[model samples]
Target: RIDAETRRILLLELQVRPGIAALQSEQLVAKAFKTKVNMLRSLGSRVVMTVLEEVLPAAAREAFRKATSSSGAAGAGRGVRPAASTAAPEPMPVAPEEHALAARPPPAAAPPNAPQPAAAPHAE
Candidate 1:
């Protein structure tokens, strides 16, 4: 299961470097996670775009769109039109339960006052 922290980090990376082609970026991420590049890349540009659209703030999204459009246009004079600047859609709010679960810190030393369970009976 992908954790919230990991997702946040990935989103931040994507936001900071949206000029990288989605496939290349996914390959890098898959390597970092010791997974098959195709597994991640298979999710496709739409998923990556959706994640960026959801996570980045309006200004960041605008910057990303501009940068991507410019880079695509520059490549072989592709003549790609700049994506229209639009207000960023509201981020899908993380569910309260998910937020609560994510916010909880890992248990500290199994708690100081908790009773230790009896050791399992020794086998012969």
Candidate 2:
């Protein structure tokens, strides 16, 4: 039998940090409480129904129900398409000279000891 006190604690923890749904579902709740997937599923459904039906106002519950129903209907009509199946095109072959040219870096400047070209004469 599930412990009411432990269930309330787990539900409160899940509500306090909504982003922890994955951890709550996959590991924490099950590991800590020694519960199985079916139990977790039933507990989650009951928790959700309690919040939606008992905690929420009548107007809010109706709106939420309508939204959920609409989204379910919309999802039924949609189908996911497989990714494009085309193979990648082969790379173009580079010419030998082009490859050699691309591999070489620009030549470095001559050393200071090396003779320099004479500068053009300036007008007075």
Candidate 2: the clashing residue pairs are none
* Candidate 1 C-alpha lDDT tens digits along 5-60: 77567656646377888788766665555453455456655565678889999899
- Provide the overall lDDT of each model, using Cα atoms, as 2-decimal numbers: 0.67, 0.66
Per-residue lDDT of model 2, residues 3-31, tens digit only: 77776686666453566667555466656
lDDT score, candidate 1: 0.67
Q: Stretches of candidate 1 above 4 Å error?
A: 1-30, 33-41, 73-124
- The TM-score obtained by model 2 is 0.24
Error of 1 at 18 (Å): 32
C-alpha RMSD for every candidate: 17.0, 17.8
